[model samples]
Target chain A: EAEVAQSPRYKITEKSQAVAFWCDPISGHATLYWYRQILGQGPELLVQFQDESVVDDSQLPKDRFSAERLKGVDSTLKIQPAELGDSAMYLCASSLTGTGVSYEQYFGPGTRLTVT
Target chain B: TQLLEQSPQFLSIQEGENLTVYCNSSSVFSSLQWYRQEPGEGPVLLVTVVTGGEVKKLKRLTFQFGDARKDSSLHITAAQPGDTGLYLCARQGGSNYKLTFGKGTLLTVNP
Candidate 1:
């Protein structure tokens, strides 16, 4: 089965350090998403991308967090000066298309971040 | 903000037992999707329910959508150890596909 791909399955960084995660959606998928999952909680959307354009980033912390998909195929999410409260599982998901409805996301094996 | 409230945050059952998890909300949704996640992994899609009062069965598992489209339920019959995982319910809000998720229920099927 085709699946979304994520890099750096695990990460450990200090409070003042920076961290980055990458994701590659399945071929032909036009919609990609980045989410953060705290322990014992469900994943929350951080950003959404439609090809190379951003669709929604209302939940994203723009000040310290940033994401981009240059070619609209692969994406990267970065956090500057990671905080201890930022420790969580970063997940990436992709869908065929995020139009009206009927888009089911396929998630990748997430990257776990632990900030001390 | 759209939110989903899941009941029974945690559950444990012996093998061959039955279990059910619920997701509810005051807000209406166009569709609801269920997912299962194991330790250290992202959630995997289980089923998607659309329309009111819709029921779909997958082998020993059954899913139901509420008539108001604001709630959904998942039932597992004769659950085995493999059924142990965190089950999450979510729905896409707004015009895009940014899914709002419930806290999720962690199920442990003991042998």
Candidate 2:
């Protein structure tokens, strides 16, 4: 099925602690995305990456969050001093490319993060 | 930012029943996609509608795009317990495959 891969399916951290999640997109996919899904709500984009460069990060909170894809195949998202409000499901997705009008995206099982 | 509104945020029906959910947007969509997510997992794409007034059927599930390109609907016929999940409607906005999703409609098909 060639699915996207995510690590640490679940995470629990206390406030003021650091947490990190990892994702590996399907082979040959050039675009990757990170999203946060609150309970009972749809996923919201946190960042988008094209190859090794960031395309958009308008919704990402810069102060405590950071993401990077050094080789463009795998990515990591980190949050320092995690807040209670940061509790959510973190998802990673990948697509063949991101230049067209529309394309199919494959999602990973996701890492559920909980900050107490 | 574009706003998407989904109706009937939650629904529950007995097995073999029929139901429909809707997704409406404040801005016109160039393309719309539907996804289904089960508990403890990420969303899976169900279908994509690109043309105005387009209709696509996947077995017992039927999807329709509004003629004005601002809304879409998903209808499930003879839904079974396996049909229970959260249905999400998403639109491709701006350049480079940026997608904005609706809040989603949670459906529970009781057996």
Candidate 3:
């Protein structure tokens, strides 16, 4: 089965440090998403990308977080000056398309970020 | 803000037991999805319910969407230890195509 790929399964950084996570969606998928999952909670959307353009980032903390998908196939999410509260599991998911209602979402193993 | 509320935040049952998890919301959704996540991993899609009052079964697991399209339920029969995980319900919201997720139900099937 084709799966979304994520790098750095775990990351530990000091407060105010920068951290970045990468994700490669399955081939032919046009929709990618970045989510943060706190302990004992569901994943929360941080950003959504349709192809190379951002579709929604309302939940993303713009002041410290930024994401980009230059070629529309792979994406990178970066958090500058990470805070202790930023510690969570960052998940990446992809779907076939973003036109109407799509059911399935392929998710990666996720990058667990811890700031101390 | 769109939100999904899941009931029975945590459940622990012995093997071969039956259980049900629920997801509810006030707002209507175009589609609702159920996912399962193990420790240290992201959620894996289990099923998606679109039409109202739809019922779909996968192996020993049965899924049902409410007639009003504002609620859904997942029932597992004869659950085994392999069924242990966190189950999440997500709804597609707005034109952004972003998914709003529920807090999730953590199920532990003891052997």
Per-residue C-alpha lDDT of model 1 across residues B44-86, encoded as one tens digit per residue: 8899899899999999999999999989999999999999999
Predicted model with the maximum DockQ: 2
What candidate 2 gets wrong by more than 4 Å, as runs, is: none
Candidate 1 vs 3: which has more TM-score: 1
Model 3 over residues B32-102: C-alpha lDDT tens digits? 99999999889988998999999999999999999999999999999999999999999976766667789
- For candidate 3, write residues A52-112 as lDDT tens digits: 9998898999999999999999999999989999999999999887355563778999999
Itemize residue pairs with steric clashes in candidate 1: none
TM-score, candidate 1, first chain: 0.97
- Highest lDDT among the candidates is held by which one? 2
TM-score of 3: 0.95
TM-score of each: 0.96, 0.98, 0.95
**Candidate 1 TM-score over all chains jointly:** 0.96
lDDT of 1 by residue, A36-91 (tens): 99998999999999999998999999989999999999999999989999999999
Per-residue alpha-carbon lDDT of candidate 2 for residues A48-87, written as tens digits (9 for 90 to 100): 9999999999999999999999999899999998999999
Candidate 2 TM-score to native? 0.98
TM-score of chain B of 2: 0.97
lDDT of each: 0.93, 0.94, 0.92
Q: How high is the DockQ of candidate 1? A: 0.87
